[model samples]
Target chain A: MDRMLSADEIVRGLLAKEFSAAEVFRSSLERVRRMDPALSAMLSVTEEAGMAAARAVDECVARGEDPGPLAGVPVVLKDNMCYRAAPTTCGSRMLERWTPPYDAAVVTALEGAGAVILGKTNMDEFAMGGSTEYSAFGPASNPWDPDRVPGGSSGGSAVAVAAGYVPVALGSDTGGSIRQPASYCGVYGMKPTYGLVSRRGLVAFASSLDQIGPFARTAADLARMLSVIAAPDPGDGTSSRRARPEYGAAVASASLKGRKIAVVRELAGMKASLSPDVEGTLARVLDLCRREGAEIVEVSLPRSLEFGLPCYYILAPAEASSNLARFDGVRYGFSRKERTLKALYERTRGEGFGPEVKRRILTGTYVLSSGYYDAYYLTAQKVRQLMKEEFRKAFASCDLIALPTAPTPAFRKGELVDDPIQMYLADIFTLPVNLAGLPALSLNGGFTADARPLPVGVQLIAPQWGEEGLLSAAAVLERHLGPASVAPMAAVKGGDGR
Target chain B: MTVSERDVRHVAELARLHVEDDEIVGLVGHFTGIMAHFNALARAGEEGRLPLDDLSPVVFAHDEIPPLRADEVVESSVGRAVLDAAPDAREGFFVVPRIMEGDE
Candidate 1:
């Protein structure tokens, strides 16, 4: 009944008959009820459905059948992911009451692996912003400091794992949504290689950049979730058909010895931009790598470091504008009454979308418009091509690349919410990987020296389809840095709910 | 790098999202600031700073094109579910505003 036990540990305990899956699920549900009031992490909690799933696992165990790899572990999904049992709000009022008739591919995979569906977690509206403050329902608080913001658009999913409501949760990262929040909330999160996991039912943000990943407190739990969800789905044409190795087994035997980890020389020039805690954490992580016999080398990524942010802002919004056009108040989401179709479309969108969403859509329309297409959108794409080539060359000299997940740790809520450009700068470190479609992990490198000790994440980037190596290195770091810890506030705040 | 209110309104119209007259000035400022950041890419391209030769836009994650599945129709019971989710539907069809005034 320990809420803090990892998904792998819970599976082992269930197998050993130490506790029924039903007991473990109820404990997690109870924890969510207790902790989520202050965290504001969950948009909705599916008690009946989750309990039914748990009992099904117990029945399998009673009948002498294997209950599957995840076996009775409770987990949550970012609301951007569709689930038939709960409404997929995507943290936007536009789709506030809309229920998807199908489950996301990851949802189906998790359920098939016997992971209980705890319900949908909150996110930035349509996953547009770096802070969850853009969520129409209100921002999810960072568990480390209630006054601070959890780095987002997957803020709620990160908080769920950090507060120990669940061992793992699925989050989709377009531009560091998963990894940045994982860093702020002090947990391990991975954005798998693009196309490795199916995007069958994930609400599209930026099609080429969006990827589904996991947040967990331990490397093994992250690996277990990845192994369960990473597979070829015929339903998703973009899903990779490349053979995937068993990630759980890969991490179990992982070693850091003889691996060459690269430190970007371009990042050194921007040292002034990094907060002291993040800079110190990155240095300490390199030191840990050296001590473990992994060689740390320097690589230059001039184009990527210089132009990644602008390139991503242009390209992601362009795709998002096209993807979100389907929500024009006619089919399944919010709609308005109008005499003319055009007026209905305009009124519905203008009223339904929040400020950030409208801003991006407008920006997207401008960039792709008649006068500016070549100068902005096409130029950004060419820059992206150069960035990809730069990464390809860097990977030739090194096994993996290292960087800070964000420029700083968690900032106070409302600090950057008003400044769109400043808020976009927060993702400077994490954008290049997504542009190149590479896999990356954010591990809690260390905490800031503040009274509350906000977490700073050290990011490790792997080459395409290099999750095996990425998870292995993360496992080694977990041993040296100590595993991710739940925020202390999860136990103290929100007690009024209980 | 300056976005006039006219340009903001034009873009909003193209995007099919109505913008209030009050919000146009703020949106113009947002666009100006965003465009200022994007100028770095344009300058880099114009100056030939990064090697932009013979490179194509990466539309897919991988270099190889994704394999296509067999294009065949399959029966599904999702018709009822789809209808149930629609804001306005009748007799298995979506309801919409009148497209033609005199034809009906």
Candidate 2:
């Protein structure tokens, strides 16, 4: 069973002349070619461009020049993250043929670090849905069980890493897009502190909540990739200038000695809401922390968890409605032929966007409407502030907070597609962190009791700019979890019979 | 608060999405189901009624002032390519339906 090499192994091997960077890239694309038809994880594969990038790395090595830290590593981009002149569909007809004029800050960073850009991966239409079912292209199949969903709107990126297609892929977390899907697909996904990574070329979903991060099979890869993309960018107004702790060094020197991790009273009381699998996974992770001499104290976040989803729904859509207005036919998205100007605007958007995208745009407009503005949007914002305060007090007693990444494991596809609320509920655990502009790392904690492997994820939430804390904890957890469990038949499973 | 089909229609109009009659049936039900959750938020349960602070909205979570770049005219390499992507384009602008029904 050939597995994709971890980023560290690939870099070391490339330098050691074990294989050329081209071979590593070709191997990755070969696996994509072998498996992606059924999985539908990829929207496009930039084979020629990727090969050219690989050649550059190999030439650097051949000429006795230093290849960068992530040399030969292949990265898949969540389609919403722009790559210059590539179709960044974001799984919608609206941007079907649209190519971004510039590369996203993350893309530029990855290329600078010598990572090969494989191509754009599928996502929910404008990253609206929990499952990739909302993807206009198609649902990305869960690696563990083909019948289940690869939780999205970063589903394709997660599946790519989980199925051993690539070592690293980038996903944006606005609400729980990155973390929940990583939990479902059995990988590590981080939503770095809001301003830690630049949002320069990321098509904005919810500006405040959105942060670009990586999905990887190992915590080491998570840290290494984070180091590359987490630099302050002049291009993004929100990119913070605060000095960042060396992320790679944090993972390398990960320790649990005297680390005070808080278990929130709010999470403890919600045993009934958590699955048996999730409960067991959290308990085991806590036990491991305890064994490592980390103190686990109980703290209270009160209604923070309960109000998180409601607050997120109100605020994200309100922000999305404004950000997505650029898609009018007059600008650069999907234009159409129409008799009247108003009809052109309406018909172009109607025909271009999928059902889920339209639903969100409408919902966003409804939330921002004059009558409902104060009642819904304003209240949600106020609640968001209170939630942030509760977390501030909780962090007073501990170094970081721990919780289940999702309420459950990867749900069977079509199980909740018709139920929009149920789909939104999939992100219940992960959204609270986003609302607070906190850093969270979702990593594979344990597996289910099935005769086969179904991975469960546990998250560590840290205060603003606390990515170092999350990385250290994740590095320790990865050692105990053995290695990420790649689904045996991941290549063959499709949610909707692809 | 109850949401009517008329409300959804108005929202869709504001959003510039012309949804069909059949789609509206599902859209109405979907919006209603979601609002039911918001309705739960409205209900002041023990969890919702917890002593919360009367805090203002923290719009941008980070407080650091954004660093501004020096204004400079940088030629875009993809300007022509962007124009080429338009469904209809002429003279450095995206073309769309004429403003009037009976005009050039």
Candidate 3:
């Protein structure tokens, strides 16, 4: 039920008339049907919409017209991204019944570029948790091993790419939602600089930090996806108007000559234990960079790593408290009727939101409340400024910063769900990148020595608006290691339809 | 616990979420555990790991703001589209529980 082809190869075949768009999409669609029962990567499949889109691409090709750059590629959207007519529940009971009236800017751009929309994938409800285990739909399993989790809130998107169900999927990273999952699932995930990609219709978790980016098997495919969606939109006031870069051009030959890559001296002392395999993978990547003529420097980011998790927990939830105030049940999503308006809100929110989301919202309310605001919220905001300045100083000496995407590889599904602090601690490396509004990419680092191949990802963070450089460096690594391969899902793929 | 069960109830009330009696115990433990992490940030400041004397809070980075357009009126069908999803709407207004007290 599986067909092996790179996303780039699929586009090449379509353009060269070697195959129809329908043929390529059918392979993925059939694979999803056969394998999704075990993986639960997607929430809904837009089969009819996909067929119509595939046929349009065929028509464009037959009529001697140029299909846009992403022509005929099947991609998944994280459930929070709006697609008109599809139920964008954000894997929350709150939005379970609501269909967005319009498409997200990224969705419109994907459709405009002739990319086939596969379906929406599961996520932590309202993008609130690190594990997709918080998803109301059910957790998305790691394709590498079903008993383990695909690290999330964009876990399903990462799994969709890792399992070869689709070539590319879009994920939003607010404190490493995209990159951590990508690292765990062993695929390429990018959290573009804040304001680089339009977040017009993405359900806002933390308005300031949330950024939509791509997940792919190859650096080239990621570049292709980035090129299409990372354009300014009038709808998103924060979307940058900076001149666009040719992201694909940098991927072919990324010479790291004379590049000073900083390995954070501070994270070396982080209390969380790194698995042996991940430590080896990080060392391998640094060695490759050294061989490629890049100078590795040890840089200090005092107070940044130590305080980032707490600061993020403070700020993301604070913004989420205000932003999520819109979902009062009267406007669109699930609501209840009561004698008074307050009771309606109380019951609806109580019934609809999952535990993690409740914790965040409650914690957010606590921090932003009267006297405690100064201690928690005010202090976090000031520290956030210090963190930004810290990154600026670090970047003054290094072209890019490198770290492990997460402390460990994909873990067992139920392991950290009940342990909120432990779950938040796992996001240590990825959070500071978002806090500084810099661009970071997670690509295949290496694998564990176990019988099953567990993928580890190395992250390279570039200064704000430095995605091109990040991609170039990742391209160099990709060339050395080869692209991260598809997760071997033979057991699940060939399992009896249960 | 830094935040007690009573505090959890007050905060939940502020956030407009109705917590059942059974959830209070778990919520208290969760908040205390997370608050311990938040305290680390406080200690970082108090211990001078980094100076936090009077640095102005940065809501967003200064250089990253997008250019704003003139506030000219633009027509859109968004009003109709937005109203389409309301739980109950009549003549473009959302119908909700009665606002005035004693109206029930």
Candidate 4:
């Protein structure tokens, strides 16, 4: 209980009666209370409900029942996912007081697996920004350095794991929300292939792009967390009906022998943007792959690297504009009492949404408006298809493709907050995989050699439904790169508990 | 591509957002900057940089169609809970501002 325990260890210990489930939950809650004040990782801590769930697990164990794979494990969720017990705020004031009526598909899955729901974590308002700075509550500071921003919009979820509040946390990634923040925080985060995870009860951002995934300190924990939630749900039309493999078992004996890993050749052209730490980390990971009997090859993704940002900006916002139209002060959330419907919609949206959400909505509206649809939205879609083709061709000769999760390590908190475009560039390397709808995982490659050493991540992407390959490669890489370490709570510069 | 404040306001109105006049300057700058970057797709197509001339917009990433569940009715017990979460609800219907000025 003194240090962060992985979900696997917690489950085993719970079965062995090494510690009561209530004791484990209390210790994790204690850690959150102690560390999260400075990090601001969680938006709401569901102490009463979490303790109740832990007691239920303890009862099952006492009765000689299995209690399930994740019995007594502590887990946090991004605020976007609905849980009947907690307010589903999505880090926005609009839904600050809204409590979901039902649990998200993943939420139900985790509960069934005996994982205690710790709380909901903060994120960018409506999952639109790269930094949690867009959160209406306030930004979550990087655990490695309080002065630096945790890459987000899943910053809080990433911080929860990195600061040892929990071993596993769920986050939704529309672009690089999970991966970039995981990289910045030095944890393992994965964005499953689109449709592999159910989206039911998850607040829609860009319906097609948003995917709920997990953040964990070790590859095995990530695999276990994913195994529980990767099943199909009837509530979501886009959820895959295919059977999911046993992810934990797949990673347990994974080997990199004879696997072909590809490096993006086009990354050379963008060298000026890549930081030395990130570049060196990628090189070292590749060397590790080579030493593990894997071949490192090169593939070109010229269109994906150069045009993915523009393509994603257009398509994601176009969908977001449509998806967000539901928040018109009518059904739920914050509402303004206006005399007319138009006034109500305008005022509620203008006052309710943050600047980044408003900006994306306006951009989406512009691209999809009259006389502009074919030029921007349609053009971006074509480019997206072209990107898919590029990945398809690249994967024909490689089992996996590796890239830096972000162009650089975590930056100063306010550095790019004012520059929306500059902030978007932080996800440049991770976006193409999302655009292509391929499964990808970000593993902590190494850390920068500074006084406050920020972690850098190496991303591994696989073909559609190729999560096994991504996990297999990650499991092997984790063996060499070493599992990610939890940042000390004292590393935070000034603990004002902002 | 240049996006003026007028364009910004028009787009905001289309999206039903109330943009403050002072914020329009920043909105216009964001619109112009993002559009300039987005224009790269069109430019690449025109320059034949990628094979986009006859490419089709991808509806989904995979080739197989998503399997549909059997068409059947399932009882939902969350109706009352859903209604309870609404900002304003009368009976079972959501209460909203009147749509028509004369009808109200």
Clashing residue pair totals per candidate (backbone < 3 A): 0, 0, 0, 0
Alpha-carbon runs more than 4 Å astray in model 3: A1-3, A491-498, B46-49
Report the TM-score of candidate 2, chain A only.
Answer: 0.97
| Most DockQ-accurate candidate | 4
Q: For residues A1-498, could you state the per-residue lDDT of candidate 1 as single tens digits?
A: 553899989999999899998898889888888778888999999989999999999999989899999999999999999998999999998999999998889999999999999989989999999879999999999888888888899999999999889999999999999999999999999999999999999999999999999999999999999999999988888888888888988788988899999999988789889898999999999999899889999999987888899999999999888998999888868998888889889999999999999999998888899978988898988888888888999999999999999999999998999888899999988899999999999999998888778889999999999998889999888888888998775333633323
lDDT of 2: 0.85
lDDT of 1 at B54: 69
Of 3 and 4, the candidate ranking higher by lDDT: 4
Per-model chain B TM-scores are 0.86, 0.76, 0.85, 0.88
True-contact fraction per candidate equals: 0.78, 0.66, 0.74, 0.79
Q: lDDT by residue for model 4 over B1-104, one digit each (tens)? A: 68988899898889999988888888888888898888877787778886777889888866557777899998999998888988899989898877766443
Q: Candidate 2 falls in which docking quality class?
A: medium
- Span of 10 residues, lowest total lDDT, candidate 4 chain A: A489-498
List lDDT for all candidates, in order.
Answer: 0.90, 0.85, 0.89, 0.90
What residue runs in model 1 are displaced by over 4 Å at the alpha carbon? A490-498, B102-104
Give the per-residue lDDT digits (tens) of candidate 3, residues A186-304: 99999998888999899999987899999998889999999999998889988888878878998876789999999988766763478877778988999999999999998898667
i-RMS, every candidate?
A: 1.9, 2.6, 1.6, 1.6
Clashing pairs in 1: none
